[model samples]
Target: MLRHEFQPGRLVAGLVFAAAGTVYAGDAAGLWDTPWFVIVPLVVGGLCLAGATATVTRGIRRRSGKKRLGRSTLDG
Candidate 1:
């Protein structure tokens, strides 16, 4: 039913970057002023968060995979 694996970490990272782009776009459109230094921390913090999320997700998937395999073996 799925074409590819869904990665939440990538999704979060993409949303963060999209937010940063939107901020700049708004500033360009005269909606608000964004400080030049704002993107630095935003991107860095987002990347860190994404990395952590990826780690957690990978751990979860691995554990679930092992459990599923174990159950299938027992059932068979």
Candidate 2:
């Protein structure tokens, strides 16, 4: 049995990395120019930082018994 766990941080990171790989592959295949290889780390790092902040903030709010505006607290 597989446990259902929803982690948007990991998903965002994975998607960013996948996009970087796709860009590299496309460049290698003589596709459109993606000369901004440096963007990969910048984007990934930004996403990681944002994700971490969000996760921590959410955890803190949940622990404090506070509710966010849109996120449902329904446990189904």
Candidate 3:
């Protein structure tokens, strides 16, 4: 069930965070510098936050059965 429960958006956001962390660590070595270095993490972090927020909201809605597509068998 974990596989079915997994959210694609969350996965993407996590990957973005992971990439940002990796880039930050690599740049910390001082081998290279770029103006976009600072901007990248902010953007990635924002995306992660947004994705997580959406995922949580969706989960809440689903748990409440507020977005079901059809009637239950008991209705019949």
- Cα displacement (angstroms), candidate 3, residue 66, comes to 12
CA lDDT of 30 in candidate 1? 100
10 residues in a row with least lDDT, candidate 3:
66-75
Better of 2 and 3 by lDDT: 2
lDDT digits (tens) for residues 37-60 of candidate 3: 676667667697768777886888
RMSD of 3: 4.9
Show the colliding residue pairs in model 1: none
The most accurate candidate by TM-score is 1
For all the candidates, what are their Cα RMSDs to the real structure? 1.5, 6.6, 4.9
Instruction: List the candidate 3 regions with Cα displacement exceeding 4 Å.
Output: 1-4, 34-37, 40-76
TM-score (all chains, Cα) for each model: 0.91, 0.55, 0.45
What candidate 1 gets wrong by more than 4 Å, as runs, is none
Instruction: Kindly give the stretch of ten consecutive residues in candidate 2 with the minimal lDDT sum.
Output: 67-76
lDDT of candidate 2? 0.72
| Residue 40, model 3: Cα distance from true site in angstroms | 5.0
Compared with the true structure, all predictions reach lDDT values of 0.96, 0.72, 0.69
Q: 1-76, model 2: which lDDT tens digit per residue?
A: 9998566666777777777778778988998777877666757685876599669867976776655433465642
Ranking by TM-score: 1, 2, 3
Better of 1 and 3 by lDDT: 1
Native-to-model Cα distance after best TM-score fit, residue 70 in candidate 2, in Å: 20
